[model samples]
Structure formats: structure tokens, C-alpha cells
Target: MDSISQLPDALLLGVLSLLPAKDVVATMILSKRWQFLWMFVPKLIYDDNYQNIEFERLSRFVYRSLLLHEAPVIETLHFIIRPKSNVVDIGVWTRTAVKRCVRELIIEMDCSSSSTAPVMLPRSLYSGCSILVKLKLKKVVLVDVTSPFSFPSLKELSLKSVKYPDEEFVQSLLSNCPVLESLVVKQCPNDNATIFTVKNSSLKSLVLENQDLRYNDIGAGYVIDAPSLEKFKIRDLHEDRFCVIENEMPNIVEADIDVAYGHPGKILSSITSVKHLTLCITSSKDAYPVGLAFCSLVYLEIWTLDTEWSNDLNLLMCVLRDSPNLRALKLEQLDCDGDRSCWMEPSSAPECVIWSLETLELVDYEGAEEEKKVIAFILRNANCLKKATISTESTDPNKRLEMLKELELFPRRSPNCQLAFYYSP
Candidate 1:
């Protein structure tokens, strides 16, 4: 303690910055050197769950700490409010943070207990925070602002289970961020946006998750028009939910498409430029464009559902036929239940399997006859394969040894290909 106390004030403050607000303030009682060090910590995180303080006391501490904080710039201000907390006090705290020139601000309300309504953020936060770089709000209500508003320097924005005023507000808010780079929106029921549209030119990554189970039949959908997107992810397993890409993402390098929609032809066609793709679908028929070619694809991951293995294999073959440059392939089955589906080999091998594929992984392998046949087909066709790994779902030693011996006996087209096996359980 004596040696640490002799360190420079800057070093001490740096250490304090990593601690939460409660702990930072508690350090004042250590010694005279630490009495005022907490005041200069640039980042403050106030989470009610950390301490057992009453709501009123927590509010007072936050108000007092912000008042005494002497930092020149608040690099980050994070607040996690509990259910049934006072909204008026939260507004004041946010306004104070905005006044302190906070670069990154996060306000998340606990919505687990449905006893309180979503907190409506202060209007000053909308118009005053011009220099904010990143803003994330969860389980809050965004009120409409009649005055001019824009986050000129904001780059990353995430809205998780947030309530917007209307659909126009959603589009307007996104359009106002001129230089935004990343956006994540997790939708909930009655998010006030029937058709969520994102039309940003500067965005490089986008993630959209639709959890609105009650509104699938109402024609609710998404429209994305981000031309510069490099990474894209969408997960909508609900039935009948649709997505429309306004333009092809020529710059996309990675993509994850997990959907149960009947027609995904348009979605698959727009991401052909992707180099790494993760695909999950419930049906195989018309899941993607008939002739769509992923010319730049180097890595592919396919997630198999509990449905028929034939449908999954058909989709796998279709994708492999188009991805001629794919070097690595991973197949993961979600479960090991139900009767094994019969495996029927295609008349011809995919170009990727014959030439480009180097690595193959089979996850949750049940060692059934159908699985063995599928593995044998790949081993026989993949001439350039270097390594193949099979992770079995069974933990029985006899079954595992039997499976390993059977796999080892399969003929490998590539003389150098190494076969590895393991029990996952």
C-alpha cells in the first residue's frame, strides 16, 4: 500500500477508471492521495445490481458524483436502471452526462419485472449530444422530437427491445446519423415499426433479430439498403416474416442467414460477394437463387435442423456447387434425436469438394449409417482435403471405437488427408 501510494496520480486514476463507480468512490477512504482521485476517472459505470443501496440513495450518489467529477471529458457513461425506478431522476442524470461531453453513453433498464413502464429519455439527450460517438439504449421509450436533431459524430447505435414513436421515426433516426458505421436492432412485439427499413450508406456491419411472434402474419418485414456493409446477420425463425434487400452488398465479406422464410432467393442473391457464410434454413426448396454463385466464398458453415437429412444434404450440395473457391466447411447438427434419415449420394461431386476444400468438420455426429455414408462420400471426393474431424454425440466407449474404426477404413481421395474423431459428451 505504501509503494502504490507513491505512484503518480495519473497512474492511480488509470487504475480507478477500470473499477465501477461504487468502488471508485469507495477508494476515497483509503488515504489522502486517493480522496480526490475518483473525481478524475473518465469512465463511470453505475449499475444498481452491484450494491444493495436503496433507489433514493443510489440516485443521490449518482447526482453527487457527477457534480463532483472533475474530468475534462467523460469517455463513457453507462447506467443500468432497475425496474420501478424513477424516470425523472434518470432524465437529470442523462442530461448531466450529456453536459459532460460523454463520447459513449449506454442506458439499459431492467424489464424483467413488468411492474413499470419503459423510461422515456430526456429530450435534451436527443438535441444536445452532438459529439456522442456511440449510443446504446435498451428497454426504453424514444419520444418524438419536433426540433432538429442529429448525432453528427455517432458511429455505433444499438436499440434492443426499444419502443419507437412510429415507423417514420425509426427511418428518420437512422437517416440522421450521417457517418454511422454499425447498427443493431432487436425487435419486440409492437415496436411501432411494421416495416423496419435501414438505408445507410456508411454502415459496415448490421444485425437484425426479429422476435415478434405475434405479428408474423401481418406482412411485417425488413428492408435493408446498406451498400457498404461488410458483415451482415439476420435471424428470423418465425413463419412468414420477409426481408427485402434494396441493393446487392458488393463489399460484404461475412454473412449469417438463419431464417425459416419460404422464399430466400433475393436474400441469398444479394450476399454472393461474401467470403465467409453461415447458412441455416428450415426448408430446401427455393431457399436461394437457382444459379447464384458465391465466387469469393472461402469458408462455409451450415447448421442442420432436426428435419430430414435429405433436405439438409440437398441444400448443402446446392451451396457447394456454387462455392467453387470454398476451402473450409463445417456442418453442425442441432440435435441427435429422431430416426436417422437415409443418405443418397448425388450423381456428381461438387467442384469445391473435388478441388478446393481443404478442411471438413462434422459436429454432433451420431455415427449412424446415413452419417457414415455422408462422411465416406466427402472423403472419397475431396481430393485436396487435409484434415477431417468428426465430433460424436455419443460418449459410450464401445460406440466411439466402433465409429472411429469405421471412419478410418473409409477410402480417402487425398493421400495426405488425416481423419480425427472425438466424443463431444
Candidate 2:
């Protein structure tokens, strides 16, 4: 105990910062030297489920700790409020954290178990806190703000299941953050914003996950104008929505798009410069725009759905034809219940298969007749192919051996190509 106590106060506070707020405060009981050490810890995390404490007790503890904390700058202030907790108390806690120069603030409300309404954050939060570098809010309501404010230091922001007042408010809030580099938005059903517009020039990464369950014919969509984006991801399961990109992302390095939208030509044309892409669309017939080429695409992953085989094959051939520099390809069979349609070979091999293609992977391989035809065509045409891996979920050893034997009989154009098989199940 004496040796531990001899360590510097800064080192002791560092250790306390890793623990929960309640545990940090309990360290005061160890010795007189540690009595006031917890007050200087830069990070405070308070979760109601941590100790199963009552709401009232947790509220009081947060209030008292903020009042006594002596840190000049709170690096992080995280809170997980219970559903029935007082909104006024939450406002007070946020105001206090802002005053303490909190850099990273996270407030998550658990509303899944209770029928209480979403907690509206204090207006002071939107107006103040110029020093905040990162902010994350979940299950909260963002009311309209008339006051002018800007988060000059904020670089990362995440909003999950948040309710917004209107489209203007959403645009105004994003416009205020001039230098935000990363943004994540998970939309809720009927959240009032019909078209979410993000026009940030400095944004380098963006993730959009839309869970909107509205069945009406009223169209909902997104307008993205982030030209500096290096990485982009979107997962929209609703087929009624649309996406419009205002500018091309020349610097984009990777993208993951899984949408059910009918026509995604505009979205596809904007991301032609991506080096690595993962794509899953509802309809692939109109997947590419006219004269659009993926000159920079090096790695491609296509998620095949349980749909018409001809459409899926057409999409695959169209992309492979345009991606002249593609080096690696992955086909993930999400479902294998499609019709066993006859496979028709392309008139000519794609430039990628004859020139740069090196690695191929087929996940969830079912060894269907159509699947075998597609695999045989790639092996016969890919002159630069180095390795091919087939992962199957079949449990029968005899079926697996027969599948391997069929694949081995296919003619390979590359002399050094190695074929490997795995039974996943």
C-alpha cells in the first residue's frame, strides 16, 4: 500500500479514469492520499445498469461528482440514462459538462423498456460547447434551434435513432459544423426529415443506416455532397427511398452499399473512383450508368440475392467488363434459392480476367449446375488468376468430394493457379 501510494497523483488519476464514476469515487476510502484523487480524473462514465442503482441515487451521484470534480478539461463525459429519468436533471448534467470543457460527450437513453417519450436535450447544448471534439446521442429528440452556434472543434458525430424537428433544422445543424470529418446517422421511422442533406466539404467518412418503416407513397431520400469523402457506407432496406450525389468522390478509397432501391445508377456513377467496393442492390439491370467506368476499382465484392440468375450474371459481367484493373473478386451467395436457369457465356472475356485478376473467393458455394458453369468460365478465362477458394455449407462428405472433383476438371488458363475448398458447416 505504501509503495502504491508513493506513485505520482497523475498516474493514480490515470488509473481511476479507466473505472466507472462510482468506482472512481470509492477509491477515496483507500487512504488520505487518495481521498481527493478521483476529483481530477479526466473521464467519467455513468451507466444506470452498472451497479443497478436507483434513478434518484444515480442522479444525485452525477450532480455531486460534477460539482466536486477539479479537472480543468473533462476528456469524456458519458451517460446512459434510464427511460423514466428526469429530463431536467439531464439538462443540468449536460450544462455542467459543457461548462467543464468536455471534449467528448455521449448521452444514450434507454427507451426500449418503457413507454416514456424521447428525452429532449437542452437547447444550451446546441448553443454552447465550442470545445467539444466528439458527440454521440441515441434515442433523443433534437428540437428546432433558432440560436446561432458552431462546433469548431468537433470532428466526429453520431446520431442513432434521433428525432429531428424538420429538414431545415437538420441542414442548419450540419452547416454549423465546418470541419466535421466523420459522421454516422441512423434514421428512425417518420422522424420528420423527408430528405436528409449532408453537404460538408471536409467530411472524410460517412455512414448512413436507414430503418425507416413508413409505407406511404411519399418519397424519402438523401442528398450527399461530400466531395472529400474517402470512405462511404449505406444500408437502406427500404425500396421506396432514393439517393442523389451532387458531386463525384474522386478521393474515395472504399464503399459498402446495400440498398433495395429500384434504380441506383446515380449512386453508382458517383463512386466510380472507389478502389474497393461491396455492392448489393435490388435490381442490377440498371446498376451502371452509360459510359461509366471503374478505372480505379481494384477489389470488388458482390452480394448475390435470391433472384433471377440472368440478372445477377448480367450485373457481374457488366461490372467486370468496366473494372479493367480489378485484382481480387469475392462473390457472397446470401441466398441460393434462385431458379436454375441456363448459363450463357459472354461473347468475349473481360479485360480484368485476362490481365490483372489474381484472387477469387466464392462464399456459401452450393455447387448448383448454374454456379458450376459460372465458376468454370472464370477459371478458363482468368489468365492471371493466382488462387481460388470455395467455401461451402454442405455437410455431406460425398457431396463435397463430388463438387471438388467437378471444379478440378474445369480448364484453368493460369498455370500457377491454386484451388482450395473448405466445408464451412
Which 10 consecutive residues of model 2 have the lowest summed lDDT? 211-220
TM-scores of all candidate predictions against the true structure: 0.96, 0.95
Winning model by lDDT: 1
Instruction: At residue 417, give the lDDT of candidate 1.
Output: 100
Relative to the true structure, candidate 1 reaches a TM of 0.96
Error of 1 at 340 (Å): 6.7
Write down the lDDT of every candidate, Cα atoms only.
0.88, 0.87
The 10 consecutive residues of candidate 1 with the worst lDDT sum are 334-343
Model 2 lDDT tens row, 308-401: 7767877888899999999999998745574645658899999998999999999999888778877898999999999999999999999999
Q: Candidate 1: list runs displaced more than 4 Å.
A: 112-116, 212-217, 334-342
lDDT of 1 by residue, 1-425 (tens): 87999999889888887888999999999999889989999889998777667889899999999999999888899999986789999989999999998999999987767664788898888888888999999988898989978999999999998899999999889999999999999988877987999999999999999856665746888999999999999999776879999997999999999888888768999999999999888776657578899999999999967467776777888899999999999998844457756667899999999999999999998776677777899999999999999998786899889888889999999999999898887
Per-residue lDDT, model 1, residue 311, is 69
Clashing pairs in 1: none
Provide the global lDDT of candidate 1 against the true structure: 0.88
